[model samples]
Target: MKTKKYTLLLILASLFVGCEDYLDKIDNIEALTELDIFTDVNLAEDYLDAGYTYLITETTAKSNQPDILSGLVMSDEGYPGRYNNSVQERYQSYANGDYLFLMDLNLGVQQRDTPNLAVRYSESWKGIRVVNTFLENVDLIENADEETINGLVGQAYFLRAFYYHLLTKRHGGVIYLTENLDLNSDLARVRESYESNLENILIDLEQAIDLLPVNWTAGNIGRPTKGAAMALKSRVTLFAASPLANTNNDPQKWVDAATAASDLINYASQNGLYQLIDASDAINLDVGHGGADLFVSEPEKLNNYRKVFVGPGKSKVLPQEAIFMEVNDNTIGNGGLVPLPRTYLTSGYDIVKGNFNPMNIGATANFVEKFETKNGLAIEDDPSYNDQEPFINRDPRFYNAILYDGVPWIVTDSAPLNTSGVADLAVINENGVLGVDLHDPTSPANQLWRVRNSTGYRIRKWVPNGFFLRNCCNAEEDFYVNNMIFRMSEIYLNYAEAANEAYGPAGKAPGQSLSSLDAVNVIRNRVGMPNVNGMYTGSTSTLRERIRNERAIEFCFEAMRYDDIRRWKIAHLEENKKVEFLEMRWQGGVSAIYPTGFSFENVEQVNLKKTFIEKNYWWPIPSSELEAVPDFGQTDNW
Candidate 1:
């Protein structure tokens, strides 16, 4: 097992994964060999620590990255940067490869060419390699006991599954690895078929389930447990056997997926993992999550929700539902990595009365409206719905997952105001201004709550305000969040999809399972919405549609939207704005200019009926990977 006490000399030797020119090779600070990193426990710990780096590194996802990649879709209207020609043209399905990574949340757009697959792919692979190394040599831990070795092994398997899951969503058919690599295999790992790759990922997950222990102790809460592994197995199986993964539109695959998802839900209560919390009483804005102390404070259940992310009252970045999370252990003394909150954790933590932020930095309105109503109906199809009442008392998951206007949310212990730059009893709004209305605590912050005839609503998903303080720093502004790679809620969603697909939605198998409706209805009831009934039985086609929308709203901003869309083969047909790359350069004057038009052609227009073909289902293989081997073929549409 890699200890946290390895020497710096050995730690520097593991960088041979990539080489450099003579000058850079001799002076490169990143160059490290296995011997350099594995010579001691600290170095060994560093080898396995790559997982933490990927999960916590905020570098690739700072500022608007999450918003652009996950939020900005065709849902919201009048969002910024949606007026350009390419975005203007492809309002439906925009997969412009040229603008790969240009993500700006406030601006409401990103260039499709702005993506950087190479760097991300490399980062993910690095974590996987570390995990592999740990799994292989964990028995060598002379310092720690056998139970410690078991725990370390479980963590490695969890990491491999988690990293592979990321790659599966990013680029389906990613190569799967099991054992630690030799020098040659690390450099030229063989790719596997999409089906084979997914199967192998599940295999890793099963092993993880057996190896992990449930209900970990203090200092180990964020680590993987048996429940986590089981939950993930359900998630991966649901995807592989779904409309997108199977692609052949097979029903049996859907059944398998549903069964897998159900397994996790079946075990939820036993694990003390997560549960719904009723907040019908917390509207006073004084009691947080309907709990004691601060009004908007996170209740125990809500705390479980926040356990995966770093925030208030939590010292070690532990999330309640985090099966496999990272540790931003600021308590780790000077040798630890925390300069300040600005760079250490970019989304500066502010503990005001407001329990959560409802800003739609990723503003996709139509997409957000996909959740089912209390009666398991959707705003888009509710028979009794008017535009104004489309979202009324729809479902409880809606509130837990997001913030809606007029819905009771949390405020601060006291209104804070900042006469100068310093915060005091008078609270400054998120806009960095003084109290806009001392008389009105419920009034929306002017910057985010701009009214369109006093009726327009935005989103507040991740922003939670309370008695919290953040120390951001540029050195590692990247915060580590325990990605919810698996959860009980997902099991329900997966069951809905796979059940409908396998049983033809009318079959009694899944419909007869009260857990199907019960699972989702539990979520709906939490939002004070009526349960979806009558339609839960018989005829799977429409029910499938309902679940699809549920996922869209439920999993938004969790980095699963694109993956879901691709699997369903619906991206092209999606009536949202197409991404464009205009090289938005300042004309050195008062305006901006398109130094170039969008780099891709045939951008799809939104709300228009055009078929997004199956070939567009998978992302194009990286050109560099193709260059690595003469035979590797890039997916079509590159």
Candidate 2:
């Protein structure tokens, strides 16, 4: 344990020393030790920042690589389009109940040299150790003021909790280590119970909340705040109350979760620190409609929701809606979630080609159907829903989050158009020259079957308006967006779920005014959608399904769904099923009813069914770790 700890410290120290050459600050690189870092405030702060490296940022959360094998692809929400890629194949194996592969991939025991294995289980321990070192030695700094010391210590507590939360979510209760372990310390510690581990995490979070400021200055924007700690507490408690963790269905657990969420809500409301970004906020903005047809009603509401994901770049202040975000100057070219656009189409339009392959994270029809219609009722329940025109008058968020047939490829001020004067389209019809075909083998569009419109649908939530493949290569138009980790909307949903389970749909936790139904409607109303349907909100059981579906839609590709289904213990039902796509064909002669002259049909992807077994709910413990500590038995059924 001491040797491993020193290795991690050396790696971080090497990085710090490399930067020191440019700053000309540190005198000795080879002789620098852990104690030296603590002697100076700036060096100690830099050491603390190394812990942030392990956090799952938006770009790395799903795809450890460029545009392949994202969490969206792993979940029922999407499909891995680049089937031939080795990385995607690895993800495919893990998604198909390959437990050993999952253990190897997550633990990185055998694949440490792999590029995308950034969030391995062992890496998290390294991060925990970095912060633990900070907490142990932060008092040694001499010149730093009380406020500075407190803030740094607060960040260390928050980071330790954050890393432990990551480990707990994936591997259940791991060996909880707070102090930096030395060689003499017990090397073979027992893994604690999940509940006990969660309690420890809550203790650290409470300390973080006590020490952290309400908000940091603009210069320190991305650091955790009091609200961030509170938000994390809300998340932790919500998971603790979930069925996977609380198998006994303890109502008190739900109450605790609801109280945590409501506490944050009350604090934000009183301080005016955060609020849901209103539809009116985007009314005067000049941003383009993110591929939504020009005719889509209440475009302002759509833009409002879209803006939340495609964040305000460095030019603008962070939106009040985002309680916490991973600050990075990310563009579509590098690690951003936006799928690579079709190269041929970009070249034909005289736009600079984007990166290597036309790979995409294709949205599954299973996920598309989860969205309720404009009236806030499921399509099967909504009598006005048009089966043939499935995309119309649905949830405004659907338009903002998904790109189906007939949606514009890009909505620029002077968008390139085909010879017919129509804007370039993401059509998946049977047109050999213009549209794509899922079945036709000889079609020219099938050359790279994994292009933007491959699965008949592409994710639009993270892809901002007026975004082009050219933006990746053009510095002038480079689109920089921040990844939001915690926001007000999520807190609302957390409160709603816990409140619903603790009390009834209309009931609230002790001393709280907001009901579960009210909390959900607040999210729905922001996007101009009607409130939760009366039919579904009558009881906690029924409303539980609605709130889950609301979370599925609201946080679509934000990398929440994978853990969500697992924690709810519904992965077996939702994940082990055939993946479906929208099969559309061009039928010529356009009309009011047959606009774009296309017909739609739901078709299952051939030979593709996502497999999730009972054992998959919890990831298996790494073989090496279990080998070292034989008493720490492997995860159940592995």
Candidate 3:
């Protein structure tokens, strides 16, 4: 018999090899020939390995990894500091009525249309094709037993559902393809209705949930578990039931979304598999006591939230908050990467604090103010929130997530200093005053000033401390911080929002035991924040606003802000809002105001107003796909 042109095993092997590491797993699989994939259990399992590569990590302009940074830049949460570059240009074009086809702006997809522009970020047809192909032939595997087969099949279904979710979320409704397409098959297909699209996705997720295990063994740490399937379902349903998608305002849809979220929460709680990683509990374990501190230089750290971002060791590897994460080495270039703050710290000419690149982008004034005070009141509302010392006594998350002036950078003349250590403080007299010489802007000791940069504050979340310049890809100490996708905390918030919408603020859905307020409190109590039930005794509308704000703070850099505002149908107002900044001018040298001696007199205003049309509720369908299927109509207002 003449050998088949391309064997399924060989095809899968080549595909797996080409995949973006997929947590460095494919390399471990034994090499097998075309027939070996079907006859060998390990090789057959490797067939499903490539599907994991479709997931996104950190967001960079050229890489288009698509995580917290992209979402922040797109929404009112933060501003894109990449002025005039592709990252800045793409965002500007999206906002200012620029044609979607003309601009290349996909946040997560790996495919590249051109060299620099990743136009296919939202496009998942190729990924779906790979998944469909696996499903079509997986049954032929002779060596894999029922359990192995079920695991692979379940993952394929979950990935297919995820890819479809990515597509539908971006372009509203997309053409759903269940079976893999052939060479001679017709490419013509029209977009489905939003409701129908979600229904089909839900069906796939249910199947995945039924087949997937609660957790995987050693070799398969990052594989989609039963929780992941349910988490995706909950998130997908949450969006489907949102105001933008649910045009009819269906109460049942909200119930469905809430129920979906509650399913995972209930299961996790009952099984004792996952819970909110409490600060007190993490501290009790003494996981993050010493070594190096991200925030304050105390021996016993109290912030579990900050520990969730940067704690070391295998025991602390995957926090309970992580339901699903994109596994990559943070130290490696472009793999599990976060923007280093040192690269951004440029206050003077010879102050080469970091290895390469100057830190440009930072936390916008509006984003910084979004965090509630320690007393759980808005900064403006909190009487103790000193305008002079705006950074002090603010939300713990603010200190952990943002790097403002007076917040120490990891560089000093005597020793390598950081926020955790009290050696050096960032003195921003960037206005260049003559008499006030303590850590002056012009002086060599104080180059860590905000006047040298565009956005006054720098991003602190997911960045390592105590290092002046870690190479972009060098990855010191082989430290890898994976970008978390779905976590228990998000599910808690999802339940809070969805249940509140379905029933009322304090009310619970038909089958649920916890009220919306209770759901919000579950997350807040873990972080030692005041509960919503105790603070806000307002109506459902007021609670709804509070729930939205909670989501903003919790999921800040995780990339949910852009979608949350859009789904809430308040994008037009939020996206068009001005980017605000707090300007700190010296009052009368450092001695007059003492420690808190600065003027909040100047609230710098920048007009970052983008053209937000009603049609902008959904991103435009890419023109390349449009040309391929001429019958497929473009999204509204494109």
Top candidate (TM-score): 2
Model 1 earns a TM-score of 0.65
What is the C-alpha local distance difference test score of candidate 3?
0.60
Q: Which residue window of length 10 is worst by lDDT in model 3? A: 9-18
- Candidate 1 positional error at 164, Å: 1.9
Report every candidate's CA lDDT. Answer: 0.46, 0.67, 0.60
TM-scores, each model vs. reference? 0.65, 0.85, 0.80
- Local accuracy of candidate 3 as per-residue lDDT tens digits, 1-638: 11223232111222222222322344433453435454555655665665555444223223332221355656765553332224444555655657474333342333332212223343255466567766766767887678878988899889989877876786778666677545345555567777788888999999999999999999788888999999999999999899999999999999998999888888988878767777633223221212233335322444467766654332327777788866543334544334322223212111223333332345677777778876778777777766666666555566566765544444334323222333222234534442121223343533442123345565666554433334343332222243677888888889999999888887876667888889987776676667764446477788888898888888776667878887988978853355665556655555434444556542445455566768877877656546656667788777
Q: What value does the lDDT take at residue 305 in candidate 3? A: 70
CA error at residue 453 for candidate 2, angstroms: 3.2
Ranking by TM-score: 2, 3, 1
lDDT per residue for candidate 1 within 264-300, as digits (tens), equals 6556655566554453332222222222422222434
What's the lDDT for candidate 2? 0.67
| Model 3, residue pairs in steric clash | 68-557, 106-121, 331-475, 333-473, 343-358, 343-359, 344-359
